[model samples]
Target: MQVTGFVPRETADLRGRAGGPLTLRYGPRAVVVVGGLPGSGKSTLLRRWDAPATLIDPRTTRLACQARMPAALPYPAYRPAVRLLHLLRTRAAFRRPGPLLVHDCGSRWWMRRALAHWARRSGRELHVVLLAVRPAEALAGQRARARTAAPRTFRLHVRRTARLLAGIERRGRAAFPGARSVLLADAVSRGRLAGVRFDAPR
Candidate 1:
């Protein structure tokens, strides 16, 4: 698997410290999974990419639900349904190919394995862009966005994100063996990410 510079340091923010923007190109039938803790700026980076891809993000599902339901309802009450819908949409998007970007919490090992398996079986390549943001920064991002997870959930995400980072540091390419992985090493900014795009290979 191809990798950009830096094997990911434990407890490091992936926005600024990492070298230049790491670009990974793939066939038009590939899917790119952007994984990180909430508020790690996955959506922000996707916007920077500005490429044509199926974007699978839970927040989009939440906004759609909010339109039909009361905004006063807590997210926990609808999270299960939202996740189910997101999964269904992901399944459908994978059927049609161009390029796909999936914004996801990188905590689920089983789901990652499943995606790896599917990519292998379908003869499509899967790539991962891991944003290793520190937890405090992630919380700040949540606060900035005016939506935050419950304390317990936030802690869980922190733990899982830390673990993923640790694995990346320890195992390098083996950590995410199924795909070519790119690690953004510090907090991201518009200036830092300028000229970044995930163009499909011709």
Candidate 2:
């Protein structure tokens, strides 16, 4: 159960129970959906897992807009259209056989439905990881990250991002009742996931 290189910074201390090499009981293709507030370490976990995953990040699009356009548009104004396009493109690209695909985005109900529909059609297993950190911790992380990277208005942007994630989670749970969901920190602390097929890097 030793996750080895697959544990994130927040989960490093919890890796003392590291066991033998990791193995998965199931062999089906998977779709890992990661959801959390702005600074819940979703990107860290995604990189650690190192699965064949597609990262559909709304923030990237916002950054792109700021880079390409003269006027910096707010993330809220541009995210929906960009997300829709990404979803359509992802569905098209994933029509063929490949490794597990992970969607690293806010877990909104509509987005979950789109993902689940693709999974069901492709006969792929779906695993949802919800990163939940304390509000204060999350805010602190957001502030620190914003200091280095944000384009404009750090505090307001972080607050909006947190609110957006909360709404997405609220909607996602109501929509996808059967998908496996776990808190990022808690799941890592537990060492191994229960229902999902998680294999170590080979």
Candidate 3:
């Protein structure tokens, strides 16, 4: 994993598939955004984190919306409402105190920009943990979890996620203006990573 911003460099050298448990440490007021393609183990990774961060996962809002809506109502019928509510909840989270660990798909520029804005205004640093996975792997992950997306929707997410990753590579630090660090983790590296931690700044 490469650390790409205002922090001291700590090269993870994960390309070699080095074996060991790894933890990402950040400031107590950091906003660590976990992102990947749909069904790319983002939720699974977030769930493994036992850090005391304020968890902000879209699944939480989506499941709540699903419960409140009629069972006959298809997901498409309430996806918009779920998204809106998730946005509102994410915005509100930035107002409260403490570290934040958010699950984002990394495809929505608007949401990321909004998060950047909040992090900047609140004197907090924004960081990203991007899980770069193959579409085939992601699809298998979806199947394993029994929560597959429509083929069309899944394709769109893959395209968007690919483009986002490309942009991050092409733009470097400019890809995320307010981001203090960007950690790119492939399957091998991700598997070795144990969790995240928030500590007082040295």
Best-matching candidate per lDDT: 3
Question: What local lDDT does model 1 show for residue 147?
Answer: 76
Give candidate 2 regions above 4 Å deviation: 1-28, 60-68, 71-78, 103-107, 147-184, 187-202
Work out the TM-score per prediction: 0.79, 0.58, 0.89
Q: Quick one: ranking by TM-score, best first?
A: 3, 1, 2
lDDT for each of the candidates? 0.68, 0.50, 0.79
Candidate with more favorable, higher lDDT: 1 or 3: 3
Ranking by lDDT: 3, 1, 2
Which portions of model 3 miss their true places by more than 4 Å?
Answer: 1-16, 200-202
Task: Evaluate model 3: give its lDDT.
Answer: 0.79
| Root-mean-square deviation (CA) per prediction | 5.1, 7.3, 3.7
**What would the per-residue lDDT of candidate 2 be over residues 15-62, giving only the tens digit for each residue?**
234343432222335556666555656665555555544555555555
Candidate 1 local lDDT, 1-202, one digit each (tens): 3334222222223455534444445566777777877887777778877766778887898789878878798867988998888777777777776677788886787777777777777667777777677888888888888878889998988887787777877876456657655444446532244323344443
Worst 10 residues of 3 by lDDT: 4-13
Index of the highest-TM-score prediction: 3
lDDT of 3 by residue, 58-95 (tens): 88898888989889999988788899999899988988
lDDT value, residue 49 of candidate 2: 52
